[model samples]
Target: MNRVIKDTGSKYPIIQAPMGWIARSQLASAVCEAGGMGIIETSSGEIDNCKKEIQIMSELTDKPFGVNLPLLFLKDDSMVKFCVEAGVRFVTTSAGDPTKYIKVLKDAGITVYHAVPSLEGSIKAANAGVDGLVVEGTEGGGFKSPVEVGLLVLIQSIKQNLDLPIIAAGGIVDGAGMAAVFAAGAEGIQMGTRFVSSA
Candidate 1:
């Protein structure tokens, strides 16, 4: 198994990225049960609902799973505290400075992954000591910016500069695409559309 999968205890190197608003426990646990890393989206500011869904995920699968917390959307530490108390071991943070929560999560023995859309962001995240980086290409889907890097370039650049595990995200919806990213030096692939579409 790839380091990313092994680190998260998933049977496969595929990660179902928490695709904004739509990512919930049902699909997240299903992915986990299917041997892929699954992530619950908790950026909606609904702490209660997040806990409820996490509880549901816990009941449905014994496999490890994670949560996606968009720093830009989260207003406090409620969700973070909740996950830790609930025994979540992996967390993927996007769209904000990771320094704020990276230490908190790491101190509690949690692996943290930050989604990066630019080389600068990748370097910064690596410096912050993240467990991994999810290089989200403009092609995959993310914050709309005139400056968007595609997976090919972003993954290569990150691989060339960073030693941490890399998970490729964006524009990949199948095995061929996953293989291409892995060949490009990514340890895993974070897929959203394939599962979201099927759901």
Candidate 2:
């Protein structure tokens, strides 16, 4: 539908955020089936288990989905390599500097997206040459920054200085919020808590 993220073959700019402890293959598959990108959050276990989840999710849907590998647990290069080998084309990294793994993933031909809570973090990710930035505000559930920037301000701040496509996360619940973010200059939007409560 002519979204910046859609350029990568996703039908919708909407992404089902990887909810770590709550993420499942079924949930990720459902999002993909619904014409949105789903992401498997692999933060709770070993690389092998994460690899298995990716494989299972891939088997469940031919559509493009992604895996979230928070840098907090990336102890070795094997996890990144495992993602590449598992045929995961897109990755969202959080909790640390994405630069350390940028070249490795890029060389493997995977699109890298970093999650940031501030303009400074966004700038750092841009400088590292990530494909996109998911600008998450404090309202988003889970490990949030204490800085307390809301969606509108955070989105605008990142938009002003970053060249990469910006995806707004936190407090977006439906189509109206989605429309608003696009109008605000974000190429895409990510919603975590909203999806978790849906029937």
Among all candidates shown, the one with the greatest TM-score: 1
Q: What C-alpha RMSD separates each model from the true structure?
A: 1.2, 1.5
* Model 1 per-residue lDDT tens digits across residues 1-199: 5789777889998899887666788889889998998899987777788889988887899999999888989888988898788888999999888998998899889999998888899899989989899888889764644677888998998888888899999889998998899999999999877788875
Least accurate 10 contiguous residues by lDDT in model 2: 1-10
lDDT of 1 at 131: 88
Residue pairs of candidate 2 with colliding backbone atoms = none
Question: Candidate 1: TM-score?
Answer: 0.96
The 0-to-1 C-alpha lDDT of every candidate, in the order given, reads: 0.87, 0.84
lDDT of 2 by residue, 37-150 (tens): 888887775567667778898779889988888898777777788888877888899989998899988898888889999999999998998999888988888788888998
Q: Model 2 — TM-score against the truth?
A: 0.94
